[model samples]
Each structure stands twice: as structure tokens, then as C-alpha cells.
Target: MAGIYIHIPFCKQACHYCDFHFSTSLKYKDELLHALVKEIKLQKSYLDNETVETIYFGGGTPSVLEADAISLLINTITELHTVSSDAEITLEANPDDLDDAKVKALRRTDVNRFSIGIQSFFDEDLLWMNRAHRSRHAEASVKRVQDAGFENITADLIYGYPLLTDTKWKQNLDKIFELSIPHISSYSMTVEPQTALAAFINKKKQQPMNDQQSAEQFTVLMDAMADHGFDHYEISNFCKPGHYSKHNSNYWQGVKYLGIGPSAHSYNSEARQWNIANNAKYIQSIESGKLPAETETLTEENRLNEYIMTSIRTMWGLDLDKLNSIAKASASPLLIAAGQYFDSGWIKQQDNVLYLTPTGKLYADNIAAGLFF
Candidate 1:
């Protein structure tokens, strides 16, 4: 019914296109961990005693920690919240960190899921992305985890960059299918401001991302996943039946969850809050028994827009009945707004549910934004 997301704010190196909060240096690592434990205890009531069905260790690179350290954090969560016995405890890791020894060590802990960051299967692309791991590490890491009896796994792949030819993209997809990894999370390359990729584009050092190329590759990705019998459960995620990431699915479904660590965000239906991004400041505030965070109370309009945005991205589509529940008759205006998309054959309705057609997915953001209150 609920989940917990813990952000481990340290990475071995920085990726060119990454904009997530992380530190290349592990200077505040030990102190940060201690403060994280304190924050967990302090925010125990955020979810109002709901059972935690997922505990995800995301960002900067959760696999950077030792097995014992990871176990300690899980143990802390168990003490504070009622975690489901079969809960999906996931660790987001880089391929280079998942050597045989590391995978074996992780198997001894509570982690039953692995979210591997295997951006590409080519050394040139890896170098271009400034990723810490190469093609060898990318393939070997997933196999090592599977070899260690970890079947609940998902690997990330990136496409739509200048160097990713159609053949190369297929090759990457083939490698994953060959590996028989049950779940995949793929994304198109985007140039976010303040990132190295953005800087490169600004200086004409690297080519900017191509929207047309991304659209073509995404179409390819969808077809390939469908051919392999993987469900396109959400826009960016695909999985064999029943292999979805419970934590992320919960997010799209609007379930309550507490976010721990710097730059983490939490939601409990009516309001949302996120901790400060500064490690030292977050640690200091937690140590002083104060939450270093900002909170937002959701208005009726805010809730409706959020629901439309998240729901439309999933296979479940947006429920007009549910939308009306948020604000009476809200779906009428939305349907009126969506008339153009309907005319374009981009959306269809059945039994009060509005589902996006395949073509509609290409402009999902635009469609969702247009229908927003």
C-alpha cells in the first residue's frame, strides 16, 4: 500500500547527461549514512502506519555501499515501519560494481531486486556518456546477478543519442533479450540544463539530442518489447508479466511513500515534501532534530493535473470516474479538451476510461498538458 525511497547521494563518477542529485566525492558518506538513519526514525509517521510493500535504494549508485551497510538500512526501515515479508527491496547499481563477489554479497541481504545501470553495450557510447562502466561490465553484471539467483532484475538502456545507430540500438536490445533479463527500463537521451551534455551542446562540443531520432527509436523500442512479450506497463518501463517495479508503479498509482535522504521527495495524497539537496545541510538539520525540507499542499487543480499526467502514461489509462471523484464533472472539460486528440485518432474511450493510442504516446506530454485544469 505504501513504499519508501532512500537516495544514496554518492556515485563513483558523474554521467554526462545525468541531472540527478549526487556527489562524485564520498567525503560526507559516513556522516550522511548516520544522518539518514535519524531521518528515517523521525519521519516514521509520514505514511500513517501503512504497510510498506516496496523499499527502493535509488541514486547516485546504491551498489556503492557494502552488503552490511545496505542490510543496516533495511533493518532500520523494518523497525520503523511494517514492511511486507515479500516486499520488493531494490538496489540501483552500476554494472562495474556488480562483480561476482558483490552480487554474491548482495544475495545474502534483504535485496531481492536489482536495477542495473547499463546505459549502452558499446564502449564508444559509454565513453560519450561519461559512464563509469563499459560494454563488458554492462553484460557481465546482469549475468552475475542472475548467476547468484537474483531473478528480479531490471537493466537500463539509453537511445536517441548521436552515436546510437539503428543497428547499434537493436544490438543493445538483443543483448538484453539474450540475457533474458525480465524487466527493462529504457529512455531517450535528453539534454537537461546544467548537465555536461547541455554544456557540450552549448559549446558545440557535442551534438544536441534529436527529437525525430528519439521518436523513431522509441517506436522501435516499443515494437521490440512487444515482440518479446514484454508489457509496456508505463512509457519508460517494460517488463515480463508480473515483473513491474512495485515502488515506481506505486508512484504512478498515487500510493503513499516516504522519501529518505537528501533531495528525496515524499507524498501522502494531500501534500508532498522533499528534503534539501545539500548533504551537509541535510545532515546538520537532521542532527539538530529538524527536518530540512519544503512541503507543498496540493490544491484540487493540482491533484487533477497530477492524476491526468501520471495515469495517462500507464496502460490503465485515465479513469474519468476517478477524475470526477477528485473534482465533480472535471472529466467533461478534459474530454472537451481532448477532442482534438480524439479527432487525430490519438485517443479512444471505452467504459469511461480514456486510453492513449500508439500515436498519441509520441505526444503524451502535449496531450496531457492540454487536458490539464
Candidate 2:
């Protein structure tokens, strides 16, 4: 099955650590919406007639869109393609945007899931990250989503910020568990090169991220999730039984999806495309009846590397037999070389599936590289 991703490309304000394509100004909102609708029509056949099982409204801040605008966009897509009856329609919402009325309006639409960006439950961490919402709003957003009867929900949390001590980090996860959030995507904070946080660290105004603390916190995350009965399905994702995110799971499984709007990426089995990150350029190009995106044709080696990268990050480890079948010539030598890591306890094989052990996960990248052609 295929999926659809629509990027909103607008935020109330920029976060210090965010490098996503978005405009602080909403002056071009009307024009952008018009161009987006046109884009939906233009890319109608990109999915090759596969029924869309997930529709994800992501980036900038999808919750910032007016309810009418959201409804209009969903309606346009439904008219253009055959969406599945039980599609996992998700909207990435910010805490500040989830007022009672807005939440109610969203529930009435085709959107069946909510993914809230609540980076932390502490005010100090929120301030440090330059988030638009306070810690209180962070807690309230998920509550409102559940209160609205939306059982399919996901929330994002950040760990390992300089300001987040182990005690505070524990509290953050505890609070989420107390609230009974079904799905969580927790990431260790990193300094993206051009973000304000990176600049601050470069100037010595703010401390650089501590790799040791980050690793330690990640261990804490694993233990806590295990205690809570949350399945560690992917590297950074945890979910209750039967509540895994279908959209992201499809992505990991190499499902084809059409990405609409600026800075979005799409992939079919053989090729991938990424839209221009600039809003003005995207709109202008689409208006001129030209799609402004670069395409990459996947070579055999590229596909192999991608499979290794994604497969090892999940509970479902890499299938050696499947690999041998798909990329026959490259498999034997790689498997022979990987035996060292396997013998050293960094990698394990069971039922012909190869995966990282807990120690191996710390160096997943390096291990994957060693096994790569």
C-alpha cells in the first residue's frame, strides 16, 4: 500500500534547534494553499493507483492550518485518489494549537490520528529550546486529544538537552506514561549545523550536546519503555501493543508514497524525489506547470545500503535469506565478514535474521558501514 505526506511549511515561530523549511510570516498563506491544491492534482498519478493507507500532515506545523483548510485539502485528495477505508490519517500538531474548539473540529474530519510535538514537560527545557508552548500546554495537548476520543495518538519528546538532567528526564517519561500516551517518538537532541542551537554552541553562548549524557539517557529510555510494556519497535519509537504508527511503519517497509508541498520527499521502489525547500520557488514552479524536485534512481548498491540502514534499526532485524535472494552476488562475502561481529556478540542471528545486540546498537552506524559494500 502507498501513503501521502502533505507538508504545511509554516510555523508560529522558529525553534532554536529546528532546521525545517518554514516561514515565520503567514503573509503568503492564501497563495500557498492555492498552489498546494494545484499540486495535489498535478501529482495525482504518482502513487501508480495503489490505495493510500495513510495520509500524514507533517512539518512546519500542520496543526497551524485552519480547520476549513485541512478539510479542503483532505477532500481534494479523496476526490483525486482512492484512499483506504481505514486509512491512518495523521496530523502533526503543536501544543499551542490544540485548543478545545480546534481539537473538536479536527476530530470531525478524516484525520484519525494526532501526533503532538511536546518536546518536554519541564518549563526550563521548553524555554531553552525556544518552543512556542509552555510545559503546561505540552501536558494539556495530549489530554485534549484523548479527551476528544482520538485513541490513535503519537507524541514526540526530546531527551539529552544540556538542561535535562537524568532526574528530569525520568520525570518526562513518567509523566507521559501517567497520561497513557499510546505512541511516543523520543529523540536525543543533536546540534544540526545551521540551527540557532548550533550557532549558540559555536559561539560558546550555550554548551554543546553531551554525547555521554545522550547515550546514558537512551539507555534509560530503553529500560523505562521495557518496564512500561512499550514495544521498542524502532530505534526511537515505542508503542503499546497493536498501536504502532502505520505511516512510519510503511516507510520502513519500503512502501511507495506521494509527498506534496515544499521540502517533502516521495519514493516509489525504483526512484525517489524531493521537492524544492523554498516556498516561493515551489509555488512558482508548480504554477508554471513544472514540478520542482530532484529525482534519484536507485542503483543496486543504493538499495542494499538503504535496506541495511533501515532494517537493523527495527525489532525485525535484517533477513539474511531475503538479502541473499535480492542481491545475490553481494551477500556471501558480506555475511562471511560479518561473522567476526557476530562472534564478538555485537550481532546475532536467529531464524536467519541478523540484528544488533544492545552493545551493538551504540555503534549501529559503524557496524552497518563495515557490512556495507
RMSD of each: 0.8, 1.2
**Tens digits of lDDT, candidate 2, 254-299:** 8899999999999997999999999999999999988999999998
Which parts of model 1 are misplaced by more than 4 Å?
none
For candidate 2, the C-alpha RMSD (Å) to the true structure equals 1.2
- Model 2 spans with C-alpha error above 4 angstroms: none
Task: Tell me the deviation in Å of residue 201 in model 1.
Answer: 0.5
TM-score per candidate, chains pooled = 0.99, 0.97
The candidate scoring highest on lDDT is: 1
Per-residue error at 43 for model 1, in Å? 0.2
* Number of clashing residue pairs, candidate 2: 0
lDDT of each: 0.93, 0.90
